[model samples]
Target: MRSKQEYMEKAEELIYKTYNRFPVVFDHGDGVFLYDTDGKEYLDFAAGIAVMGLGYHDKEFDDALKSQVEKLLHTSNLFYNVPAVEAGELILKASDMDKVFFTNSGTEAIEGALKIARRYAYNKDKSHDHEIIAMNHSFHGRSLGALSVTGNDHYQEPFKPLIPGIRFAEYNDLDSVKALMNDRTCAVIMETIQGEGGIYPATEEFLKGVRKLCDEHDALLILDEIQCGMGRTGTMFAWQKYGVKPDVMTAAKALGNGVPIGAFLAHGKAATAMSPGDHGTTYGGNPFVTAAAAKVLELFEKRKIVDHVKEVGDYLWEQTEALSQKYKIITAHRGLGLIQGLELSVPAAPLVKDALLNERLVIISAGANVIRFVPPLIISREHVDAMLIKLETVLKKHS
Candidate 1:
């Protein structure tokens, strides 16, 4: 086998330079640890950006994938498959939504949700120009349609002339959203808990107010739970905690436990908007991906992953809070369940790099100053203790 440097060099020559990735090349992973090409083990706190809810090398997930591969991979959306049906039913039941449209990724789910909102409005009144209100500092996805509503100017500036009629409002600020809402507004989209903007959970008041505003205006409420959904926030869906139901919601990440699958869910009126031929995908909801997704839901049911996340998440937050109290550099921290963030007085990039290279810990930064921790839902107190030890060492060195 080639050395780590050799593999990285080959990748540099062939792959597009979209990500400023770490130097080490990961070979494989098991549970909460990943092994580099050189066989160096590193504790995984990022969890593939909150996608690997069950961790790596899970026997049940692996066996399900293998069985699906032997039976069928792709038969297109034109036909019905058992896994697809089962996965769809599971998602609807878990989400408390009436209908589901599975896509290949989170971005596609956002795209489909956007289309459904627009079409729903257009079908009602063709003459009115539909407007979508999104939150500032929120991230939906990288695709053009998904990118259009993303609130980051840095990400949207380069790709000018994006889809029109999408406006941005301040997150967690109810008045800002109300100020922008009008008769032309067809939908209001936001993350139930902001992820890339930093792990900021929406206030109960703000979410309830938004829901009321949408109801008054007869506009759809689209919650982008792509990053915070699927038991990441100690619930099957994050919105459940807020006592508000969205007309539409997008979910992915932990939905497949690392398999590439996403979905946009709708309820009541929003659910019936997309008729036949309104929207479709070629390889979406195929047997292979849906089989993996179905298995993930099954494991969640058997393992009671939501309850586990709640207990473990409280422990992790307690540890992180103690760290903040001990170190002045850790200015603040906020989160719910496994998706948490620590805001630093200094930039977090160097610290993240140091943790990976020196402490052999895998973590990521959010919005420059916030260090994000999105570990697998299955991690134990021992795992949290191990991560905190290394993390404290890194902080001490920096201090």
Candidate 2:
């Protein structure tokens, strides 16, 4: 096989230069570890940006995918497939949502949810309620419709004249959301736990208040759980911890255990507005991807993954909290489950680079100054201890 440097050089030549990726080439992985082409090993704490729920090359997930490939891969929405139905059934049963619309990615799910929110309002009264209120520092997606609702000015600045009628509010601040809600507001979208803006979770009281405000105003409450859902934070959905249910919910990331799949769910009344021909996707719920998703759900039951996440997440938080006191450069540690973040006094890019090159630990950043830890749900206590030791040594050296 070619060396890592050889492949990386070719990638820089051929691939789009949009992303400033780390200087490493992952060849294959298992559980919470990855190996580069140079035979170097690294503890994979990023989990492919929170997508690899069961970790790399999970046996059950792989077996399901192999079986699905041997059978029918896809026949489109023109006909029904068993894998798609099974996945949808599990999602609905778990979430108590009335219906589901599958898509290929998180951004597409966001778009579909936004469309449902607006279409539901339009059906009631056209041209009246069209505004979508989102939160500041929140991330929905990169597509035009999803991007319009994202509240970051930097991301939206280049793409001027985006889809209008989208307003911004402060996350976890009930008054900011209430002030933006009016007759024109069709829906309010937000991440239950703000993932990209930093791993800042919404206060329980704040979420309850928002639910009441949306109910009182007759506006749809949309929760974007793309990152924090799917057993990442000890629950199937983060909103479950808050005790508030949204009219519309979008999820992806870990839905397929690594396969590209996203779904937007709607409750009884909100789902009714979508008709047969209103929306569709070419490869949204293909049998191959949905089969992987079904297997992931099955593994969840067999493994009791949620309970594992709760235990491991608490252990990680405690270890990280201790590291915060030992290292002055570390500011704070915040999160629930495996989805945690550490805030640093300075930019964390260099520390991350050092972890990869010097310590052989693979972690990603949430923002400029925060390092996000979202390892595979199958990761054990021993894996956590190993990572913590390497990470702590790197932080001390940098400090």
Per candidate, the number of residue pairs that clash is 0, 0
User: What residue pairs are clashing in model 1?
Assistant: none
With candidate 1 superimposed using the best TM-score fit, by how many Å does residue 107's alpha carbon deviate from the native?
Answer: 0.4
lDDT of 1 by residue, 1-399 (tens): 999999999999999999888899999999999999889999999999999999999998999999999999999988999999999988899988999998999999999999889988989888458899999999999999999999998999999889999988999999999999999999999999999998999999999999999999989999999999989989989999888999999999998888999999999999999889999999899999999999999999899999999999999999999999999999989999999999999999999999999999999999989999999889999999999999999999887
Worst 10 residues of 2 by lDDT: 123-132
Root-mean-square deviation of every model: 0.8, 1.0
| Candidate 1 TM-score, C-alpha based | 0.99
Backbone clashes, candidate 2? 0
**TM-scores for every candidate against the unseen true structure:** 0.99, 0.98
After superposing candidate 1, which stretches have Cα over 4 Å from the reference? Answer: none
